[model samples]
Target: MNRKNKIPKFIFYMIALWTIFSTAHAEEIMPKAFVYTEVQNSVPFDQIPWKSRNPIISSQPGFISKTWLSGSGNNSVGGIYSFDSIENAKKYVTKFFPNAVKKQGVAHTSRIFDAVIVEKASRDIGSAHFGGKISTKPGAFVYTEIQVNLPFKNVPWQQRNPIIKKIPGLLSKTWLSGVNNTVGGFYAFDTLENAKQFAIEVFPKTAAKMNAALYTRIFDARLVEHASRGMDSPFFQ
Candidate 1:
């Protein structure tokens, strides 16, 4: 099917799966925390030690998701990867990339940080393509992408729901899961400035609290447009 047709079909499948699995009472899953190291003055796009390791690692059982390599734009050698569960994710790291444990005369380094999936939502319709008539103005709508690790297995929906409501400038929020149940969420904001400000001011405070409960790493970015074009979509409303 074409991309347009796939959207609705994908939505339907996701909803059906959600209805079936919502009641399973599974534990909250978290991804392994790891940093991909790149040399500060390395050659551009040249093959390196870990260059081919990503595909091999991502194909493993517990692998949640992996980002594609950026060729020219943002030529950083590092990217994020999520896993189904912390234990499995860590096992994979130790088994496959033992050298990552120590920088040990290596040109690059990898460090694993503690992480947790705070939320997961499915059947999300892209806000940019929702077909609803909404004004797009400066500071009209903003998208906040947050990655934080928090403990508290089976986080009380009561606690999370209230927190979502309290976030300033949150027009809407949605949770999502990708391959192997990588957990994450997205928040819509009234303005780009509002989204940026929240990430700068409120997110760190929240992360600090979350880290106290569970070791956590965070990545916060603002979406320029709301077309839902990225992999992170389909789960964020």
Candidate 2:
């Protein structure tokens, strides 16, 4: 073929290849978001009927990216579950686990919020490290919790912000109101160990200053999946 003919064909081929490559890359790095739902109730810890329902719910169709359960160390309790898709997460709650919900008699619940898994680190070296079903990727996952008392609704946001910011491994923070008859915030950490240490050392003092109690939990990324949509993009860079 002549040079002029060949040149045009080359450009067309290049365009086609570029288009395919771009599409494939987009699919590979497609942003992933997590749905976080907190369930709280007054049911007795040992008597709760999660054994029959939780396993089935967890094994449901879609994708239960990650999940974790933490006890309140007393009667009142709460737990967080993360799902790959909002639809799947909602289905598990509204459809699959109807019986479980009724059994617990969930007093109050929060709307499903989206979270993104931004920076993942290793968990091997942390004090809170307790190996589990999840893999060990050094700092891949972190968990955090704070317990505060009620009747202090008028506290300054400025004072509360610093206290949460000081906690080690805190990736993000958000406050939930009107459940468990108390007001408190949840924090995302970089490692379980860091989260545990912070709860033991720093959280108490902060809670005292705010006139609140403190409760905390931590997990590895393999065991914990988070999706942050709308609030703040985990992939800001």
What does each candidate score in C-alpha RMSD?
Answer: 11.3, 10.2
lDDT accuracy of residue 89 in candidate 1:
55
Instruction: Give the runs in model 2 whose Cα sits over 4 Å from its true position.
Output: 1-98, 101-153, 179-181, 210-212, 226-237
The pairs that clash in candidate 1 are 33-112, 33-113, 121-175, 121-176, 139-191
Give a tens-digit lDDT track for model 1, residues 83-157.
556666567555655554345443443333333333331112222222112233223222222243323244344
Clashes, model 2: 19
User: Across residues 123-201, which tens digit of lDDT does each residue of candidate 2 receive?
Assistant: 2121111111122233322333345434324535455566565556665544433222344444555676776676667
Once model 2 is optimally superposed onto the true structure by TM-score, how far is the C-alpha of residue 148 displaced, in angstroms? 5.8
Which is the leading candidate under lDDT? 2
Please report the TM-score between candidate 2 and the true structure.
0.40
Q: Which ten residues in a row have the lowest lDDT in candidate 1?
A: 122-131
The lDDT of each candidate is 0.40, 0.44
Q: Which ten residues in a row have the lowest lDDT in candidate 2?
A: 121-130
